[model samples]
Target: KNKYALQLDLVKDLEEAEARLAEVEQKLDPVGDYVEASMIAAASAQFHNVVAQLRILNPNVEFVEDGLDEDKE
Candidate 1:
């Protein structure tokens, strides 16, 4: 029981760490359309990779899509 509790605590810590990292990343580089578009794109790609890894680690998770317009499609 103690071991299970410790494991849950560790998982919570990891989740918090990931959220903090993401927040820092966003603060450091505010998203916009400018010369830094390439940098933003790279950062976004890296962020997606990290998120994918997290999804794999946590099986009971679903990723949501953004900007889905039926007319555009």
Candidate 2:
């Protein structure tokens, strides 16, 4: 298997899921909203699920945001 390919594919999923999660998290009032809070919770769960999947694919591989995270590599 191509490790780069695996990483590339899942990183995209992680990014998308994280984007959705962050969007809802930033826009919603977690303490005052119920339905919107559920949406945030769902998105958050999805983001973590993708991270779990990536780790399962390769426990030693590191996950990073392509354009958003600090680079030392």
Candidate 3:
């Protein structure tokens, strides 16, 4: 089995997924009265989920945005 190729594919997939999640968060940005509290919470949850996945992919990777609780408050 070509383990290197498999690893490369996995890395590519993770990068793409991260990009898509970021785009979702960007789209969810509050805009006037069209935004709701529930939507903000959902976006926050998705962002945390992505951070968790990234950690799983690379245990040594450190994310500054993962400390989002302080920012949210």
- Model 1 lDDT on a 0 to 1 scale: 0.75
Q: Candidate 2 lDDT, tens digit per residue, 1-73?
A: 6999999999999999999997887677556577665777787777778877988998999887455422225
Clash pairs, model 3 backbone: none
Pairs clashing in candidate 2? none
lDDT of each: 0.75, 0.76, 0.78
Error of 2 at 33 (Å): 1.7
Predicted candidate 3 versus true structure: per-residue lDDT over 1-73, tens digit per residue = 4999999999999999999987877787736334476767788888889888998998997878746744353
lDDT of 1 at 38: 74
Q: Ten-residue segment with the worst summed lDDT in candidate 3?
A: 30-39
The C-alpha local distance difference test score for the whole of candidate 3 amounts to: 0.78
| Each prediction's TM-score versus the true structure | 0.41, 0.41, 0.41
Candidate 2, RMSD to the unseen true structure = 17.9
- Name the top TM-score candidate: 3
In angstroms, how far off is 2's CA in candidate 2?
58
Higher lDDT: candidate 1 or 2? Answer: 2
lDDT measured at residue 48 in model 3 versus the true structure, 0 to 100: 82
Candidate 3 all-Cα RMSD = 14.2
